[model samples]
Target: MPTGVALREVRAQLFGAADRVLRRDGPSGLTSRAVTAEAGCAKGVLHRHFADFDAFLAEFVLDRVERMDEQAATLRESAGTGTVADNLTDALIAVFGSVAVAIVALVTFRDELRARLRETWPAGVPVLTEAVVMIKDYLDAERGLNRVSGDPEGLAPTLIGSAHLLFADRTGTPPDRAAVHAMVTTVLGGQA
Candidate 1:
């Protein structure tokens, strides 16, 4: 909007605006105009950076997925350091307490967006699938270190699914940390 000043981190700013739009208005409310308005820029700001709206969306989802990779690495490193349930509890909070839930809903509601994502993400929802991978990999690491038992591959989906249900359908504010911890502890079946 400034006459001469250039915007730094334009992609981040747009992506963040889109995410807020998605969260406040859901998938239907996420549009180029909405995103641009939220970013305090002109509509061309989005098209200028992306081939189309779907392109911007795909990049937005991918950017969040990349964040999950970092979270996965940090989680794997925490293996054997804390109680298994506690670590999982924290990780679940990190995953859902962010924008993963909203992103999942967006992917579910948009057909073209889902199709566009399938080029790289062939199966499962984008943000949710990536979160599942993050949890599963960390669980496998914990299992390797003898910090956890049973099938992590099986447990990971259940944890993600259950947590998804818990985190989804909220009015305002995320589920309490104690509630998430309780769910994790329950899913672990005394493994914690």
Candidate 2:
């Protein structure tokens, strides 16, 4: 929104502001005006860059998915370096943060945003799917190193499902790092 900032920068700035608002005030607080104000930009900036509020939300959700995918891709690097539970907890925290929960609430209540997202991602955004693949890949790598046993393909979904439950409980206190580690340990058959 600042002078000389590139389009990509503006987009990133807007998304960052939106994420902050969503984290602080939940989905209901996210609006073009709120995002612009948080980003320190004029209100027209969002409309000029995106077709409508739904379009902007769709783009925001897609951008977050892409970022999660990127983070998942890096899981293999941690395969043998730390406890599997620790590694998994790190990845899960990255993918299932407060912001993600807020986004889910937003899309669930907003038909236009949900429709726009489905138009782009018919398989429902692929966050869990991408995360499963990454977890499986990391598990496979660990299995090869003789650090873990069992079918990663089976465990990945279980872990993802548990993480979804943990993250979706926004009304309660979030699971702490110890709880995350414990869940990952249970999934890994005490390998942690």
Candidate 3:
């Protein structure tokens, strides 16, 4: 790119580039240089916007988490309208559809990124943590409607952890949707 050309939506463009790097190359391949290269922007563009790579990564995770909040709202609205297992299952698929799993791996390997995230999150991985809370909140809504019975607090982590495992690694494809549905059903079978 040019030295003086303005980059519109620079953060988003860089974030999209980083996400692709994380997905394609995994954490090992994700670096400021790679991201800038992938983004077709000068390396200085990234440094100019964010203090460091870790700061950019933390902001990226925060942006994704903010997006997850939209999905959470949608899921909560779905509490009484569908089979509990299916609703939960579909939500899992959506949340795990791409970035969350890779983000977990990235956070695990990057000590500085984790530390920066902890300043605000102070508890868990951003997407995963939001996922757990999303599930728990949805389950709570279902319980209130008597559509589901059991402890949402106890079940949320169980469900999210299981779902996370299903999406974590790949065999060229995500776990079969039916299999995931079955897993959710079995978990909630006693409750519903």
Candidate 4:
């Protein structure tokens, strides 16, 4: 019988292979044979470690989400007393950078993975909704402080959609941090 250490080693190898396949070939390349080839292991090793591709994909996406959420939480905590733009920008950069691979995974499996995501990705909606609320709160607070002028409630969704589309774009160049800030700031001004 395989020892616990041996089992962990095998699972680690499989996850590494899966990660590489996801990165280099997108989500469609995650077949059992593909993973095994990447790992330089017997083809059956993948099935031994995971029930199937769906299970592996679900786990991998969930892992990425959890890691991203943790990073976002850290950024939110450390943003200090910076302007709303500064804090929000730092938090978004952390969240987006970590979840770039997961975003690609979602794009690759757009239709097939939605149900699994609904089940496993509970934080998805809440985090987004909270971000919008935070944007509004920042606007209100900053307006009170005279740092910004406008209704955040009206502008929050536009900013959210801008960031959403920025990452969703498969074009060779996605908007950089400055671009997003400029776009969001413009949206903020338009609400005035």
Candidate 5:
């Protein structure tokens, strides 16, 4: 909010504020005014940067998706270095954290935001698709190291699907590290 703050810094601040509002108060609490207030900026800051609230929301979701994709991509670095279940549990935990859960919930409940996202990304925001790809790529890397036996094509979706369920159940207690490890182990046919 300070004068001369870089545009990227302002945008990151706004996005963080929006993410906090979404996580604490759900989609209804995510508005330009609320975001600006939370970010300690003038109310017009969001409007100045984005065409509209929907546009801001779309960009926020896309940013989070890119972050999740990056996290998933790191699995390649850990391949064969630890127990497969442990490595996967760490990745899934990163993917299903509070901020990601909030963004998913926000996009799901807000029709206007969803529609705006579809306008920009006709194939839909590539969060899940990209996650699946990253997971498969990691699994393939592990396979090459002889740490995982099965085809990643079959395994990635099953793991991701279950992770989705675990992530979607916001009303329930979130899964812990042990649970995530168990789920990954099960999906890998007890390879862990």
Candidate 6:
């Protein structure tokens, strides 16, 4: 039990270090040595916790996505009977904000690492699946009271994909949240 507890602690430390590295300097800043240095441990500590840098990066991305998923789940529960636009806007902001962009970069630019990561760890997919299901559930519930036009299951991915792209590009031009909300309102036919 003590060993398990210690391992969990070490994993948390590794994840936290990864978060700091990614947030401060983006994916380029992530290195096993850098993580160990931030974690105040020897380099071998990461190897013990993760298979390699790819595994570490995958866990880090998934950890952030899980955090975002939890937040969105809570918002979904609390915001009962809210307009789809409002709910989607809140959820998108919660799930796919600037920090999410950094995560996407971490996963996208490092393909070899990402492939290794995917072979061992399926990052971000489950959370996205849950989001889609939740949105579909919400739309199904609201169909009678709301004027939902398109299929929520299909629209959910499209909406999320758009946010993903916008985040990836980092255009720094459009008012992203508002524009996203507008798009959701138009595409999903819900009150914005």
Best by lDDT, which number? Answer: 3
- What is the clash count of model 4? 0
Better of 1 and 5 by lDDT: 1
Alpha carbon deviation, residue 108, candidate 4 (Å)? 6.1
Q: Over the stretch 1-192, how does candidate 1's per-residue lDDT look in tens digits?
A: 533336689999999898789878888788998998888887877788899999899999999898888788888898989798888989998888888888888888889889999998899998888888888898898889887797888889999999999899845668888999899888888887
Candidates ranked by TM-score: 3, 1, 5, 2, 6, 4
lDDT of candidate 3 over 64-134, digit per residue (tens): 89889789999999989968888988999998886888899999999999999999998989999889999
What are the TM-scores, per candidate, against the unseen true structure? Answer: 0.94, 0.85, 0.95, 0.65, 0.87, 0.75
The alpha-carbon lDDT assigned to residue 127 of candidate 3 equals: 92
Per-residue C-alpha lDDT of model 4 across residues 1-192, encoded as one tens digit per residue: 122333447766777777777656666666777877787777666666677666666665655545554554544454336656666565555544444534554535655555565685654543344455555665666666666666667766566656766665433465688976666656666332
RMSD of 5: 2.7
lDDT of 6 by residue, 19-117 (tens): 777777777888888887787777887887687788777777667656755665665564446566877777776666546666667766788666865
Q: Would you give me the overall lDDT of model 5?
A: 0.80
Angstrom error of the Cα, residue 184, model 2: value is 0.9
Scored by CA lDDT, what does every candidate get?
0.87, 0.81, 0.89, 0.59, 0.80, 0.67
Error of 4 at 8 (Å): 4.3
Report the error of model 4 at residue 192, Å: 14
Which clashing pairs does model 2 show?
Answer: none
How far residue 42's Cα lies from its native spot in candidate 3, in Å, is 0.3
Comparison by TM-score, 2 against 6, better one: 2
List, residue by residue over 125-180, the lDDT tens digit for candidate 5.
34666667778999999999988999999898788779878777765788888888
- Backbone clash tally for model 2? 0
Badly placed stretches (over 4 Å) of model 5 are: 1-8
> What is the Cα-based lDDT of residue 78 in candidate 3?
93
